[model samples]
Target chain A: MTPLPDAPAAPTAPRQPARRLRRFSRAERWVHRGTAWLMGICVFTAACLYLPPLSELVGRRRLVVTVHEWSGLMLPAPLIAGMFFRALRADLSRLNRFGRHDWHWLRTVLRKRSKEGVPAGKFNAGQKLYSAFIAGAVLVMIGTGLLMWFTHLAPVLWRTGATFVHDWLALLLAAGITGHVWMASKDPEARLGMRTGSVASWWARREHSLWKPDDKD
Target chain B: MEEPRVDDAPDDPGEENERHGAPVGRRVVLGMLGLGAAGVALGSHVQDRIDAVLAEVSAKDPTGVTGLLPGGGGFRYYSVTSSVPKRNAENYRLTVGGLVDRPMTYRLADLQAMPQQRLVHDVQCVTGWRVPKTAFSGVRLSALLAASGVRPEATAIRFDCFDGAYTESLTLQQARRSDVMVALTMQDKPVTHAHGGPVRLYAAPMYFYKSAKWLSGITLTKSVEPGYWEKLGYDVDAWVGKSNGRSDDPTS
Candidate 1:
């Protein structure tokens, strides 16, 4: 319309390469990996301790006890250390807060409905719930483990209850971890995100459309 | 970004009712709670029944493995010998000698007649099982040591068992704790042979190994001698939660 102004040729947008989205920061990934390894050792050593055949095969009860106790004691170390990182703290806060969307997502998943309409942000409702559960479990385990270790400090009833809870929760945790591994295996991209701290942008958009990076650069 | 809307109608009307059925959720939660309570009650009942059966089986078991199974009161019977030696109260004798000013031998009755002290303590094993609040009534070890007039140079106490092979020891200081006793009864009843009866050393704060079973001798020594399990790699000190490089909870 403005031949006179010959309208500055419509400004061309600069072309950019498609880049991977940052899913988990380096510190977050490290905390996850460290806790995962420690938890694996704890569960394995505990099995060795309780199962007669496993105990006999493993032998060296003293060594196994030491490994189990120390690994359990250190389970929370990485998470505690990661609190110093801003991104991790933010992510943790996000995980801790449950909203209507989360409830909706949980309902959809529980009913085996397509997750297509579920509104999830950086972490899905299932992931958030699992994170919260694991954090609570870690604390409970540490408390009970210490009581068991320092036998004289607590009353017999408390110790007994602690042992009961610890044992049952351990079994539950094992099952939960197995399910988590299966899910992760099914979604290789999720595993890739944890391992490499990034995921394909399209994968993130499809799986977590609500997760918009603040700075695409 | 705008927050996701929760009030939007679910894709299927039937699904909404199924998903948000509070009455169903409540019933499920209540059912789970009821099941849990029932489970606990059933567990205790089963435990009691199992204990009774185990107790009966232990009375006849020669291998002692059946006795090692955990019972209702956290008690387990562990015997190192093939069979519990037949020792009646009339036949049992406890001898205290070596480096002591007064060497004395007393029948089970004589030890039982001494001023008795009752204590409840946890019985800890090197293998990791624990029985709590086990009651033991007997003459205090300190009282016995005092009555025997321990010699100053006698730095340790050696224990010999009627089982013939098992032996244990304690330092002069350890043998004197208020909790240590030459126990004649356990759980308010006479100690059973399978449990190291007619009389056994009750080192309350130490592991069960340090509490020599089937006590037949207590000899004062110039130095500490490791016990049977101790000789075979168990901790000599065997303090609850402190020995064996394990900080187990004290069983006191």
Candidate 2:
């Protein structure tokens, strides 16, 4: 997709209609989509494994287990690969910074009368928190999952503990993802931004008031 | 004169009896009924039903996913082959031959009629998981060997299963351990097919793989023969604590 310059629409025109601004770059969208696909397979196979009724219906527990394990092992691959992309690195830095407005945004966004969101950058506080949780969760799940799959590598007590942690953390992660999806549904612009790597300039101006289309690393 | 007072007395004694005796009698009856209900609830019949349900569920799950979760003694159903041929009492047979003075064949009924030894031991799998205090009852392997009269040249006993793929062996010394048996019952009930029932070997001191399931033949060999899993890199002597390079507690 061709990116438009943020220059004033036309010198002859007094005021311009809303423009499309770059939100997620092509590399960022690729990373996000790839991670989502792998995580989806992991979740589906995990359901087949953890639910007895579903296991019976599926009748290929071995295959489900193999798919779950491999997908989980590969969960961080996209993020690692995307580090080479300059745009993704820049976006990651933006996600890492937490400004005063973010804390204010988190505090006031839930209030009944707070229609206009607190000024945010390319990423908001909630998004950052979610990203942090997911990153930590993926690491923990992979560690415990490896202990379970490779029982010979650890003691019985360690393996047992791993199983316990793996099972419980999976439930929490699932709930967190559900909330993430719910929040995403509320902002179609954000979803479209992820999909097409651009968002309506007016939408960005309202949600991420501090973001500028011309800003670059 | 005394007989006149003996008539149904409506006195303090009778009132006291009425006050305490009726409720106490009712309570005793209720207590007895509660005990009876408990006995039935914890009885073999309920245990049998539980075993059946577990077997049915595990059977439906080929990968033994249920075994990964806690409960039901943590036993994973493992079979080397995709499908195992089912053996029942009417069709089941055990042949003891090879390097024996008297080759003998026994039916399910014959094995049941022999003296049975019951064992309560933990079942440890090589892949890691222990089901503690599982009960297995059957004729002792030593008894079977003695009856067949082992030949002087025989040094090991190789056991075969109706599953058609599995074979396990133990040294004559190991086989003669009082703990080893040809198991007919498990968990206080006839072993369900899912758990390898009717007749199977029980090597109490070794990893469960040594206790071959769906056992069909017993051959006395001149030397120790590695069994199914052993051929695939599992230790031939799968003693719980001493073998398999694992330091887990012994099944015994």
Every candidate's TM-score, chain A alone: 0.88, 0.90
DockQ of 2: 0.01
Locate the minimum summed-lDDT window of 10 residues in model 2 chain B: B13-22
User: Model 1: which residue pairs collide?
Assistant: A150-B249, A151-B249, B241-B248
Fnat of the models, one by one?
0.01, 0.00
Docking class of 2: incorrect
Q: Could you give candidate 1's per-residue lDDT for residues B72-103 as a string of tens digits?
A: 23443444444446688789988899998899
**TM-score of each prediction:** 0.53, 0.63
TM-score of chain B of each: 0.71, 0.72
Which runs in model 2 stand beyond 4 Å of their true positions? A1-26, A33-72, A101-126, A141-217, B1-87, B90-110, B126-128, B147-149, B157-169, B198-200, B213-222, B228-233
Candidate 1 C-alpha error for residue B246, in Å = 18
Error of 1 at A29 (Å): 1.1
Residue-level lDDT tens digits of model 2 in B1-252? 011132222233221121221222223334444433343234333433544576568657878765544333355566555457778889999999999999999999999999998999988876555676899999999999999999999999899988778889999999999999999999989988767888889999999999998899999999999987778677888889887656777777
Off by over 4 Å in 1: A1-18, A113-117, B1-252
Give the CA lDDT, 0 to 100, for residue B234 in model 1: 79
